[model samples]
Target: MRIIAIGDIHMAADAVTRIPEIGSADLVIINGDLTNFGGTDDAKRVLDTVMTANPSVLAQFGNLDKPEVNDYLEDLGINLHKQARLLRHRLCLIGIGGSNKTPFATPSEFSETELAAFIEHAYEQARASIDLTEPVEKIKIPTIFVSHTPPFGTAVDRLASGTHVGSSAVLSFIEERQPALCICGHIHEAAGTDHIGRTPICNPGMLSKGGWVEITVNDTTVQATLHDRI
Candidate 1:
């Protein structure tokens, strides 16, 4: 399967108009930040733009998106926040929205413990359909975890001041769960990839700034590429 990942557009809903230029894919995953404190109307506008690209889309709201916007996205059946869906029989996609606490106290910030609990809950939801008899390593299905914040200490979480401002809880979850891919954003300046064990993590950066990640997944391998476009 091919996936196009976009990040942190932050109110520039019009940017989706150019998504097709980046490439074609089976799915488009909007990692987060579709709006800047936007409401249902704004979310709808963004979704409309995404539809223009004519691909199946899944999205999670970023810290900058208002909580109510989730309602709109849910109504449209494109919200991936705190939910999981089968991309194929052997692949599942899970998502967690919002971000860990920051100094600025963004409206969607969560404490470390809170974030950890949320991750655990979401994981359980993701695996609910699987047979409990199967061992963790024995399960053939690959999982993709989508979050709005990168894990702590990764290249994608670095700030201009050289600080790694990501979620330690997310870090812990990735280390333990070891999903096939962890896609994130929110730290726009540090758009890149990092590894937690065998898993690959990506921050596609700010979509409004022409950044995106293209991914290709097959039975034996997964490829994620970061890009800078105009």
Candidate 2:
């Protein structure tokens, strides 16, 4: 599967078409902040614009998006907020929307515990939906966690001030479960990749700024590449 991950859109709907492989990618995952506290109408506009380029899309609403936008995404049947889905036959996908409690108190901020629960529940959902009856090695399906916030203490979470403002709960989860990939965003300046144990973490920054992550998943490998602008 070829996947494209983008975040912090902030209403730059036209930018989706700017991606080099937007139309051809197997899947497009919008990490969050599709609008600036915008409602369903605004969400619809942005999502529709992306659909123009690629119809296959899964998304989560970030802190900057209005709380009700979650329901709007759910209605669209492309919501990945605190949810999981099977990716072809190669991977399991899970995600959590919103950021861990921020000082600005954004509309979709979540407590650390709540964020932890969200990912855990989503993982369980994914596991329950799949039949894991193969051999031990065959049962290990590669996983992707599309989170809105980068995990704590990673290169993708550092800001200009040098503080790691990501979620410790998320960090702990990654350390424990070690998903094959974690595509995160919200900290715009930290548009890069990092690692937790063997799990690769990526922050694609803001889509409006032309940041994204390209992922190619096959039976042998799941490769995520950082794109500063594409």
Candidate 3:
């Protein structure tokens, strides 16, 4: 599966247009922060641009997003998986939204404990809902987790204070349930890739500033490339 992943578009529709076509992949995952203010209109505009790309879109709402904004995206047929999904024959994708509590207390800010609880709930929901009769093992699939907040201690999560303010809860979750890949983008400056356990964790950074990650997944391996648009 070829999956192009980006995040923190912040309502920059042109960034979506700039995504290079991948003839090999089966889907696209927009990690979050699709709007500047989580306004319904902004979400709709972003949804329209994504749909035009003509690939399956897996998305979640960022802290800037309002409830109505997410609803609007759902109405437009964008798959909003706060939990998880199995895509094609080889990919299992999961999403978590918002970020650890920030000073601003934005619409998407959550405490570390709160974020952990949400992630746990999502994982339980996925386990309960997924059919086990399928040939591929759910746990063994090339699972990719999406979150608006980066995991702690990654290059893609360094704050202006030089603090790595990523979610420790997220890091714990990944440690407990190691997935094939993890993608995130909330700390714009920390826009890059690294590893957590066996999983390849990536923060495609802020698309509005022209950063994105390209991923190719097959039965044997997964490869990711990070790029910045000039």
Candidate 4:
């Protein structure tokens, strides 16, 4: 499967026009930040543009997006926050939107414990009827996790001050679960790749700057490429 992962749009509609390079993707995953403190209408406009660009869109609301945007996306059946869906190739996609609390006090903020609980709940929701006795490594189908905040101390969450302002809970989850892939974006300055144990993590950066991540998954492999428009 070919998936285009993008986030941190910050209301730059022009970025949508430059995504033809995402060509023929089976799915388009919008990590978060569809708007910059905008309302539901703005979220709709962004989502509409994305839907027109790619019919298969799974999105979540970011810290910059108003809480109502979540409902709007849900009403449209494009919301992925705390949700999961099956994709082609026996792949499962699970999403957790929002972020850990920041000094800025964004619209969506969660404590470490809250974030961990949210993840656990979401995982349960994702695996509903499936037997989970088998180790995650033994599962035939691969699962991909999408989050707004990068895991702690990763290359993708470093601040300008050189601080790693990522989520400890996210890091712990990655270390423990080791999902096939974890795609995240919240720190634009840290648009890059990192790893926790055997799992690969990616932060595609802000769409407003024409940055995105392209992922290709096959029976035995999953690869990600970071793209930045000049």
Best by TM-score: 2
lDDT per residue for candidate 2 within 1-230, as digits (tens), equals: 79888889999989888889789999999999999988888888999999899999999899999988999999889999988798776788888999998889789998899999998788778877676543212365788889999999999999889998999988998888788889999999888888999998989888878898889988857899888876
Residue 159, model 1: lDDT of 100
Model 1 agreement with the true structure over 106-205: per-residue lDDT tens digits: 7677788987887777677766756555533347778888989899998989999999999998899888878888999999899878899998998878
Off by over 4 Å in 1: 20-24, 135-137
What value of lDDT does candidate 4 attain over all alpha carbons?
0.84
**Deviation (Å) of 70 in candidate 2:** 0.6
- Residue pairs in collision within model 2: none
| Candidate 4: tens digits of C-alpha lDDT, residues 131-222 | 56664445777888899999999899999889999999889988988888999999999988888999999898888777888888898567
Winner on lDDT (3 vs 4): 4
Candidate 3 runs further than 4 Å off: 22-25, 129-139
What RMSD does model 2 have? 1.9
- Distance from true location, Cα of 51 in model 4, Å: 1.3
- Cα lDDT over the full model 1: 0.81
Residue 187 local lDDT, model 1: 96
Rank order (by TM-score, best first): 2, 4, 1, 3
Could you tell me which 10 consecutive residues in candidate 2 have the lowest summed lDDT? 131-140
Q: Rate residue 228 of model 4 by lDDT.
A: 80
**Clash tally, candidates in order:** 0, 0, 3, 0
lDDT of 3 by residue, 1-230 (tens): 67888878888866677677733446777777888776888877886787677457777888877756666656756644467676654666667888888777778688898888888776765565555643222445666778889999877789877898899988988887877778889889888788887877888778877887888886847778888873
Q: Order of candidates by lDDT, top first?
A: 2, 4, 1, 3
